[model samples]
Target: MLDTTKYEETTISTTPACQEDPTGVNYRGNLSRTIQDQTCQAWTSQDPYQHTKTPANYPNAGLDNNYCRNLDMRFTAWCFTTNPGTRWDFCAVGYLDPKCQATPACQEDPTGVNYRGNLSQTINNHTCQAWTSQDPHEHANTPADFPNAGLDENYCRNPNIENTAWCYTTDPETRWEYCAVGYLDPRCQATPACQEDPTGVHYRGLLSRTIGDHTCQAWTSQDPNQHTKTPANYPNAGLDNNYCRNPDGVNTAWCYTTNPETRWEYCAVGYLDPRCQGSVV
Candidate 1:
């Protein structure tokens, strides 16, 4: 019997210091070989391996030719190797520090969650109150309450499922406000988290297909499968098109399956780890 493991990663020497990207999302260098020294395969070609992650599907992942990219938002950027024996491997890339940036120019935050820019003012020209202060705007979105929300100073952030990055305004009348501080650049948005959202309500990541590689049914349509989770009903649930979401508060983000037999199914949510596969309907 033939071994059927799709990706069998090989252990190799440590990548040279010159090639290292911690986040693996913003490494646009020319390091075209995997850590195992295998030449990277062209993203457009499926000669050695027939894969689903293509440039056409992930236009923002910077899948230029064959350079390693973190399309799945993995620990780092990786690529399909040209060597038929080896399936894929991580590459040497640099983690562009998110704190080094001064302003929010080309920084793309699709979900507005990973925004680490220093945008402290609302669209109405109101200075945002510090996350630590509660003088005028006494709310629970403080550093003490949500530590990992990047509640530093008063930078706009979408810490907890807000429409976009926003902050508590210093203006007494207007307690809080949303900030227009994302998707300014057409380059590529920041990579989303690789874990499944527990509530699946705030999962704005881009995984349109289902776990079984089936195309998801658009949320706007009530075609083959009719259900209550529609864009009109759940306007704030990010129920756009065929993208998967847990608007009804399911265990995880799911979408109405295009297959009439299967009404709906959970999505992979960008996680491709072989160990944690989700169940299919």
Candidate 2:
């Protein structure tokens, strides 16, 4: 739970001028650049939101503890809102005459450093940023040309990642890529997207935790519309049955459902989720 005292700045101070560092140095009005003890790495975005490369003469020192000292959610736009078209930059500088008044007199980053453009995650009760190196087009690690290996039963293991005819393929890295949320690769365990194999089974996605005696798609988390899980990943969801898809979605192949009767209406055909006893009931 959020401490109301801290949110209101009653226990803390908002005036950057009144802020202080660990060494007892008062930071009054010298907020232009990073000062070892005074300036914080995480803060409200600059008045004129800047992204891509760090800009010189950038205004706004940012909030101290990544806290929303002042939130004007009434407006359609917000400081925390990100725009991926511009690499998840914050709201335009003059959009809402934006201002993120953060609470707490102390700085979030003592050293005052962070990767300029990266996604943040909660780590050890602190917001930790990470590489946003996103490659949505799946344009890497593809072979230009190769002779097919003889057909075999142990081939095409990762058809989801690499959709090539693996039975005749010849290589261990056929469909190698980063792991997904519920299907973390045992070989690539160090990635950020990797999830623990909770069910002592692989390839179940979130279904790794078996419901009765089965895996992913056997039992879903929620209506697919609100989540990102899709039939491509959870093929066991049944032929054209989108119930196992991500939540909040409407007609997308991702898991979705307005109600029980129409659950499989929009699902892709020829795809039978493993849970339907090989087909729908």
Candidate 3:
């Protein structure tokens, strides 16, 4: 016996959509291997969305490979094709299209630890309720951890460390204590710690608070007596004063040392304040 249903012919229909940008060129990958891609490459490499660049030709670029399934390090969405019926349909997210493909969840970490990485993150949002992850170190924008203020001579500071505070910036020229906000905030506002100048910071070694891009030099601990003014220990024997601080107390107090920096050096800690005592007292 033959079933008539087997002979019934069915028409295949595929839903098509206009190629639109869910995220701009910034969030898009290279063009979908087309003449437009070659045309874009021939233009300028500086801006992806230059004159010759066509958004419709390329697939979306993103920090994350997930196409609306997983959140980025900043809780933002990546991939996310605008074309609904296309092969690159957003998975896991189901149907409702996200407005911004590269926006972070509008949420904040309840524990201050999370704040160390996302200071600029928003607080209390419905869309961002599900996102929560972080990088290893701290972010320097929140008001949670009251970063300890390190003196010019202090080094090896970390937010994870029990007693240490955020290692603020030091003026290479003036050698004054200042926060990332650019002030003499001995009590740095509780915020994410910046690793840019992780080592050499304001009011640190030499004490002058001038802006020069220099990575901070890490040491075992901030000990004044430990770092003696020896030829080997001091950075530049003829150039800068390489000595442990005086007084030996933690937090900006220079330890006892004989080789103080020059007295008139405006940027030196001892030069800014008499207590630093540029010369061995």
Best by TM-score: 1
Q: What are the runs in model 1 whose C-alpha is more than 4 Å off?
A: 1-21, 95-141, 144-149, 152-281
| Residue 158 shift from truth in candidate 2, angstroms | 8.1
lDDT of 1 at 129: 94
Better of 1 and 2 by lDDT: 1
Task: List residue ranges in candidate 2 displaced over 4 A.
Answer: 1-147, 157-161, 164-184, 192-211, 215-281
Local accuracy by lDDT, each model: 0.64, 0.23, 0.23
How many backbone clashes can be found in candidate 3? 39
Q: Which has the better lDDT: candidate 1, or candidate 3?
A: 1
Question: Candidate 3, TM-score vs. the true structure?
Answer: 0.17
lDDT of 3: 0.23
What overall lDDT, based on C-alpha atoms, would model 2 receive against the true structure? 0.23
Tens digit of per-residue lDDT, candidate 3, span 96-142: 12221122221221212222221121110011111111122223422
**C-alpha displacement of 57 in model 2, angstroms?**
74
Error of 3 at 115 (Å): 13
What TM-score would each prediction reach against the true structure?
0.33, 0.16, 0.17
Segments of candidate 3 deviating more than 4 angstroms: 1-132, 138-184, 187-211, 216-268, 272-281
Candidate 1, pairs of clashing residues: 20-93, 20-94, 21-93, 21-94, 21-95, 22-95
